[model samples]
Target chain A: MKILIFIFLFLIGPLTFGQEALNIIFQPKFETENLVINKTYLFKTDTLKINSFKCYITNLKYYKNDSLVHVSRKRAHLIDATDSSTYYISEHKFFRFDELRFNIGVDSLTNVSGVYEGDLDPSKGMYWTWQSGYINFKLDGTSSRCPGRKNKFYWHIGGYLPPFNTLRKVSLKLNKSHPRQIYIQLNKLFEEIDVSEVYNVMSPSDKAIRISNKLQLLFKQVP
Target chain B: MKKTKLLFTLSIFALLSFDIIKNTYFFNPPQYFPQPTYDFQKNPLDSNKIELGRLLFYDPLLSANNSVSCASCHSPFNAFAHTDHDLSHGIFDSIGNRNAPALFNLAWQKSFMWDGAVNHLDMQALAPITHPSEMGSTINDVIEKLNASEEYKTLFFIAFQDSIINTSKILKSLSQFQLTLVSASAKYDQVMLGKDVFSDQEKNGHQLFKKNCAICHTEPLFSNFKFETNALPVDPSLNDLGRYSITQNPEDKNKFKVPSLRNLSYTYPYMHDGRFATLKEAIDHYTSNIENSDRLSPALKLPIKLTSNEKVDLIAFLLTLNDKEFVFNKKHQFKKISIETKE
Candidate 1:
């Protein structure tokens, strides 16, 4: 009985302490295969090609039974299509979590505060230079359906002021037993709007706000 | 124990020396001035950072073709305001819409630019840097160039402890230099400080200014820094709707920020578009040419009826506001930076 008790104590000690990393993979797919920059894809019989895609993700948090369990130390993350390590979040040890919560863009308070470093820096190509604001979500591409010079289409969405604030919060329930992976599906995003009509969104306007609200639907925790 | 004691004495000396250096570059505005709005805690002034900012300010490499710089329009000799040219000339002889305003006493300004578009001083440089007709360059390209340069690499490492050139450090360094541009040594300031007395003509002009212009262009700072319509007829070609373009409010149409009266002698031609070439013309517009429009500020509805004599006296008082010491300050002048073209 003494030997059994010693074995039990050793097994339980390993479970209680240390750190864990969560892989929040943002997978942008073009139909079946993964999305590649400047690669042509069939868009319901129309030819489509994406040149650039980027967005800011912030306010990462985790919850268990509606109680806050973890929060991210990173102020903001600029998730560029070319950079795979941008969205992966590593957190301190937590026993259990039922919900995955985060924002699709930087908050209004952070926007007006001033400048930033690292991923939030203006040199990241996500910040607007003329007026003060960050380009919260950017998607530039070329499609046969798009009507423009060289068949180009760009949607640079961002705003912090009221009536046009584009920041979005996404809270998704998780199965405690499975690995955490957030998938951002491009096919679902394409279905939401026609690329021809809503192509040029470069500033803070009603269209930018509407598209930002629609972005919450693009993220999910399921397979 | 003797070695430890010696180390402690050396550390104390180092701290004292650093304190003196910091004070030299410190944002020390006059006691009469209001508290500065800049959050110094965010980016504290360091001698190295200010020097880096000065270098960046004069570097033509900031422009797209490496031909124009911030000093191209905001020359130091004219109180950092471009003289002769009413409309600012940008890269490749491209003309900008508005006159480049003088840069001084910026620490007290709550917002920047003629339309108050920029909420912070740190972000103000972005406008000129990226404007197509101005610098015609993007912030990313500028940083890439700076990162590639050997001179900037060394300067940046000295300014910021780490050598990584980022936007936060860049803007913070620029603000540190600009915040030190305190124009508080004018003859007007001397009179206020009781060191000197105003001339009889200036004394009368001071009284006239108090009665007519005091409401909008307030004292000490010389501007209330609020948006007000002075009722200038819109140019048919430009039709610039000043503050309304930023806010999109009907009430703000044709309303530009009330400029500071200090350095009025240096910053010209006056108004948002540099329409008036002389002080007399600017004053005359207020007294006689104000359009009877509802958009006009209540003070401008009556627009002070200054006699020709009063106008002369007011000009005398305005000239006293110029601080010659500031415009000629060697510290603010250009120190040429040599750069290697990124291979």
Candidate 2:
């Protein structure tokens, strides 16, 4: 009986400690090397500065050893594109997180009409309040190759209804057993998206759909 | 050991039963209606939170200058809608574009506003709160003020189990309180349930309403809640393209969500732009004043030819729709504690 107890303890110890974890970072690579923060335009755009860019990675789930496990939602929250101090995740229950998976735009269920707040809040500069939809991926900046000389490019993409629904699903595998960071290249997203088509996507329309489709293809799994 | 196990089991059982009773007592619904659109699971309705919402609804503190509350335009006495004015007056006596809609049975409404611009009732308050001519305050600013108020902090803690006065909690509690404003005790409801009889004139009017307007204004809720053009000419001054403003589709131009007739007596100056002041005027519009348009509802294609007597009968039928029980319910009234504190 004592030997059996010893065997059970030994097996449980490895089960608890053998799990692996990974930290996934969604890095936005700008077309130009330099990016402008709130007021100041800086020369370094390759490195994502905290508090400068706001994007949501919502409804994150972990798929390990086949079965699906739900991770704490607020754990994966808003990231700043300017300040490094503000760049880290606060709720770290998944500190030993082995894999990372999440969707960019809101899930189809939330896309339907109802009350929403936080990243889903209509006033958070992420949603188009007037249109009753979310801007799935917002790429706002000034470009010289468009009309009005200083063009403001806003990709307000999302709608569940026909002719305007722009929901995109992105899936990636961590590949390595204990990967530390996952990198996303935003420059590739713009390469596929014609600055001309996206330049005019001011609302939820066919253009928004085209841009979202193109942007999804640009998200690559890095080593 | 047996006695100790029994005690532990009893305590757990007590806590479990307490939770069950709590849920049942909190989620009582009116038998007449279907389930509410709001998923209480996301934001559970607590008595404290509901009370907090009630206070917020009546509090003028939500406004930028603290001069007007939602009740200013939508008073409880008038079934949460203002009287004597076709248009709603906002902060600094500035008039809004449309009339203030009566507030009640909101849980049943999938969309809000005369134009249906706001799809969710949770986000409904933000429109009036942010409109430059309306309250002129951001939700975040309103939250900041609520957070600073010691009284509000305690109330939020009670209602949400958390003292954080964020926009979500504010909007959720407000909606929970509004959802509880179910108006089902109207004279029409009694007549429908066969508990009471309508006057002969009211009965004839009811028949006329069924024949003429029932296609759009369906019974029980008194509204199909669908958008209809109704064939009325656009007010030249307002030029409001109701649903089209939200949809941006030319087909939805001039289409407005059908207003519920549960409290038609108190909620006067009907239609989206408050075009008709009286039931007779509205009946006349449906009869003789329907403008020819591509988006006109099929039911209203043929002009309704109602005699003066028929118009009076329609008015008599409309009077039965008034739910006096809802208007006078003390639970739906202003928070006495805050009012007393202020006094």
Question: Best candidate per DockQ, number?
Answer: 1
Give one digit per residue, the lDDT tens place, for model 1 in B304-339.
888899999999998889998888889898876553
DockQ of each: 0.66, 0.38
Candidate 1's C-alpha runs over 4 A off are A1-17, A31-33, A176-179, B1-20, B23-25, B336-343
Off by over 4 Å in 2: A1-20, A31-52, A59-79, A82-102, A113-123, A144-153, A173-182, A188-202, B1-35, B41-44, B336-343
lDDT of 2 by residue, A19-135 (tens): 433345554444433233533233233222212245556666666654565464462254445543333433333444345566767765675546565556655666554545566
Maximum-TM-score candidate: 1
By lDDT, the best candidate is 1
Tens digit of lDDT per residue, candidate 2, span B1-343?
A: 6776576446545534544334336455446666667666676665665677788889999889998888888888888887667888999889987889899878778878887767677778877888767788787789889888867875665455577777778888888778778788888878767899999999999999999989988876778889999887778888888888767788999888898887887878887777788877877788888877778988888878899998999989988989899898888788654311121
> Residue pairs in steric clash, candidate 1?
none
- Give the lowest summed-lDDT range of ten residues in model 1 chain B: B15-24
